[model samples]
Target: MQVDSDPDWSALLIRVRDHEDKAAFALLFRHFAPRIKAFLRKSGASDTLAEECAQEVMATVWHKAHLFDPSRASVATWVFTIARNRRIDALRKARRPEPEDLPWGPEAEPEQSEALELRQETARLGEALRQLPEKQRALIERAYFGDLSHTEIADETGLPLGTIKSRIRLALERLRHQMS
Candidate 1:
């Protein structure tokens, strides 16, 4: 069959969407499936993964054909966009830690001595923070405690970016020295 000679893909998709026409769906599958697989492989999916994801993408195209907007995109564009999103989802799923690999049950509590040491360190850090010059202390609090970026702090305080960075750097150096 001449698969690439300008068939009305959008019309076929509409048939799949509205009439659930098997002939139209077969035509779309024949035309787009291999292209989707090749696209996935080019985007760095392994052969097996590409093949699997291509099948899934085509299935999605079949099921979601009603969502297709010919005015917004051609059928090829819609199909490839689904293929791309499926690849991204597959990559994310592959990267996720398997449930079997995770540590089970509640975490062990810290030893009493370790807890005491942590409290002491916290006290020292608090004292050091209190001893900092108000300007430096305020910047450090805004950055580390308030969870604001230097740019955000600058916007809030109307300080130059350089001044915010410098004060934070100096404050960190002093804290490091005190901690050590």
Candidate 2:
């Protein structure tokens, strides 16, 4: 079959979203799966790990296609983002500490005052995060909670690496000021 080098991805995503169109999904899978696999491999995942992550990413796209927002991100960016998140999650799970063989023990609890202070600090940080600009907050969340590198963020956001770094740096400075 002849392939359109520049297919209209937004249209395909709409089809996937509105009608659960398998043909549109097939087109997306054909185009993005190998790219996602390559991206995972470049990030240091093994071939088998990359393949599994790529499959999971595509499956997520099929299931979550309705969540796609073309105004916010192109289809490739969205797919790569899913792939990136999946890879990070897989790595985190693989690195989880193994449970010890010893029997469970009742560990000492923290002091009530210390626990209250920690909770207060968490609340403050949450408020500060809420006060940030939408773009800034999104960058912060993607970098910290999403575990995406600057390069990956740039790719997914379709921004320059320098822009991503600068925004993150400025956002961090603002957060520090707000916290203080």
Candidate 3:
């Protein structure tokens, strides 16, 4: 009967880096995959995601094994550090919010054609109001832009209430026809 000897992880990593050793990689995978998976799951990942991330961490180890420094950390420390960083990156990606699509908001832009039509209609209404008699223009301005009730306009202008209402009505009818 052959006795099983514990393999050196640092030597296995060096073999994988220098010689692309499959047996060394298999040894590393067998030793570390389950531990990495457990670490990820304990840190809040689902089992399926933990499995996938463990596979990625091992692939990184295979490619970057040459970067390991034995003086600074043991093979297990290096591998587990990589696994922890990968878990942080995955959590950040999962938690990020997607961008909002915004024609539905309160500040949404009007269509170009509709905006242009409103501008032209406003210009026409302004020209129609300018063409009115100055007395009528004054009464309309006081009632609408000046925010005055008929009684207020009459008090301000020393005009009869009936005269103020009639002038404003006629001015609005002219503006409607011109705009239409």
How accurate locally is residue 73 in candidate 1, as Cα lDDT from 0 to 100? 56
Q: What is the C-alpha RMSD of each candidate to the true structure, in Å?
A: 22.7, 15.3, 32.2
**Tens-digit lDDT track of model 1 for 62-159:** 89987775545567667867876676677655433324633533645334454335445555776788889999997775663343568978997999
Candidate 2 local lDDT, residue 75: 73
**TM-score of each candidate?**
0.49, 0.50, 0.48
| Candidate 2 residue runs with Cα over 4 Å from true position | 1-5, 94-180
lDDT of each: 0.75, 0.75, 0.73
Q: What lDDT does model 2 reach?
A: 0.75
lDDT (0-100) at residue 145 of candidate 2? 43
lDDT comparison, 1 vs 3, better candidate: 1
Query: What number of backbone clashes does candidate 2 have, counting pairs of residues 3 or more apart or in separate chains?
Result: 0
Steric clash pairs (candidate 1): none
Best model per lDDT? 2
Cα deviation of 159 in candidate 3 (Å)?
82
Q: Model 1's lDDT to the true fold?
A: 0.75
Candidate 2: worst-modelled 10 consecutive residues by lDDT: 109-118
lDDT tens string, model 3, 1-180? 001233557668879988999999999999999998887776668899989999999999999887765544557778977886787688556433335733444544335455434434444565787888888897765553343568977897898999888888888888777767
In model 1, the worst 10-residue window by lDDT is 96-105
